[model samples]
Target: MSIKKLLFMVVAFTLASAAAQAAPLRVGVEGAYPPFSWKEPDGTLKGFDIDVAYEVCKRLQRECVLVEQEWDGMIPALLSRKFDTIIASMSITEERKKKIDFTEKYYDTPPGIVAKKNAGFSQSNMAGKRLGVQRATTHQCTAEKMFPGAELVLYASQEEVFQDLASGRLDAQISDSLQASEGFLKQDMGKGFAFLGDMISDPGCQGVGAGFAVRKKDTLLRDAMSAIIKGMRDDGTYKILNDKYFEIDVYGK
Candidate 1:
């Protein structure tokens, strides 16, 4: 009956109402992209993208729902509404822009090549050699255009590409530099292999690094998440996540 008690009850009710109305943000992730996202032996998803997704949803005050999707199907699954947004490390390429909108870049590592130590491969001398790349990715585009002399082999996942490279089925492989270092090169199977040459420079195909993809009409969601990404960088939250997965800042200059 007191005014103080009435005001406290009103605020509590409002808070509870807002909590009840908060919808879950479904995030699409490739559970096979190492360091970015991958599955554990028990099938639990963990990686940089997984961590970022949870953090973004936490800041947005929404329940986080992760949708596991294959790399090749990421955009199609997004367009079909299988998930509300893609937290997958998908590049912001011009070709993909036609199908979906992207948040501002979350990270901008360059693509690089992995080849056996002492291999006499060069950017212009890979004729008849098999080069592996993830299908439908910026790496594939760069390899196709830049290394026309090499035979391009496509795989559904980067893991497979690394496997073929390790087994000598592939002469070399192209992928995000950080992922190649952390996911493959540092492992035992990657022994005697080293990153060859400079990072692949193809701005037209790689676009402006990686971003969250949402349905083309979901500009509001895109902007909201983009703002959260910037806040994380400003507050050092992004660095914590970046350091957990990489030795250097993958967000680029």
Candidate 2:
């Protein structure tokens, strides 16, 4: 080929690749919950949920972009096409299913309660204590339903709930066990806190673990994401990522 022709072909291929990369699919994340999704000191989002979403995109042969959205508004944003999907450790529940479809669950964790260590309260003593949980989350629903008379204080994010609990504004807090273990119980701020043994058992409150949320009409996107999750499960990549952050195999034996 002539030098001029070869140069032109190279330029054309470069432009095509740039366009493809620019057309990445945007995925929403809360960017405030550690061990699941959180923003680093440098303002970049990083966590298990973010990693899992990237892996799924890799399998689908699509470029992935992370969009930070408030946890409370994630669903509404997705429905409005603010993003193509949500991988913010959102639990797949029937209520959510009514508004949006989900890929197969990618992770599962139980619910647990955190209370002041010397508050003289155990799992059995949670009758009237004020409990804090993130608004619109399964944890909040579980706390309200399972502990009917207990006071429930809803916050906008897990960090806010924990902050209140740490400041003694809340008697206790309920959240995902993995997050409790890794992000709270294992942290410096958790030194004086303890996890009560009681577990919230409502599948609806706990949901069917966590999954990717896509608009109900996006069957192509949903199926493609589901296939990626299933393949990861079969090949052990999913478990590896889970264990890296959770220190436990969340996928079960």
Candidate 3:
């Protein structure tokens, strides 16, 4: 009836509408591996994983909050409720399934090893060489298992592993093949480095590749995310994001 009353009602309605549309969700991503997941200097998390998490939230019509977390403790953090879900490129392993559930893999890629182009590192004579690997990764387990006799050097992040390799502190490094190629080997710091051999695809050791790890109790959310991932793939959103960071289909079989 009154102008003042109408204004108050409009403001209240606007606030309610905004609140209804903004159901916040916190997502954890490993902010180290570039082209996949990494944190900017200003502490913003960005990359394929972040984009996918945001896209999932968009599909769910919710507000997604990105949380930058170190890779090793991402599962523990998830169990502790540090975030609602993990979009880090964590593998969908049975070992992990015991602790957390995962949607079907969002993408599948093999691991690769890198060394100085002239290093002549090979699977045969790697017996005593120092190898760098990120801690708590399938790469660490697979490298240790497959390349026995080489001394394993573990780091918290792939960035650190590459740093050690570039500085000659490590004879070689192993990580996600795409990350090894683009995140390090193709960069200036990786100028002298090159992949040692074929991409390693030990499904048992590497799990079934990368997927979203969710709390075991969150079945509804997990199903929602799985459907979203498939929708993104079928609708070409996955291709657009994949091509933005990689030349190949990271979602491929």
User: Which candidate leads the pack in lDDT?
Assistant: 1
Over 65-127, each residue of candidate 2 has an lDDT whose tens digit, in order, gives 888999889999999999999999899999889999998888777888888777787766677
Which candidate, 1 or 3, would have the higher lDDT against the true structure?
1
Lowest summed lDDT over 10 consecutive residues: which window, candidate 1?
Answer: 14-23
Alpha-carbon RMSD, each predicted model: 7.2, 6.4, 6.2
* TM-score for each predicted model, relative to the true structure: 0.91, 0.88, 0.90
- What TM-score would you give candidate 2 relative to the actual structure? 0.88
Q: Candidate 2 overall Cα lDDT vs. reference?
A: 0.85
What are the lDDT scores of the predictions, listed in order? Answer: 0.92, 0.85, 0.88
Q: If both were scored by lDDT, which would come out higher, candidate 2 or candidate 3? A: 3
CA shift at 46, candidate 2, in angstroms?
1.0
Error of 2 at 51 (Å): 0.7
Model 2 clash pairs are none
Angstrom error at residue 82, model 3: 0.7
| Cα-based lDDT at residue 248, candidate 3 | 87
The runs of at least 3 residues in candidate 3 whose Cα sits more than 4 Å from the true structure, single-residue gaps closed, are 1-22
Better of 1 and 2 by TM-score: 1
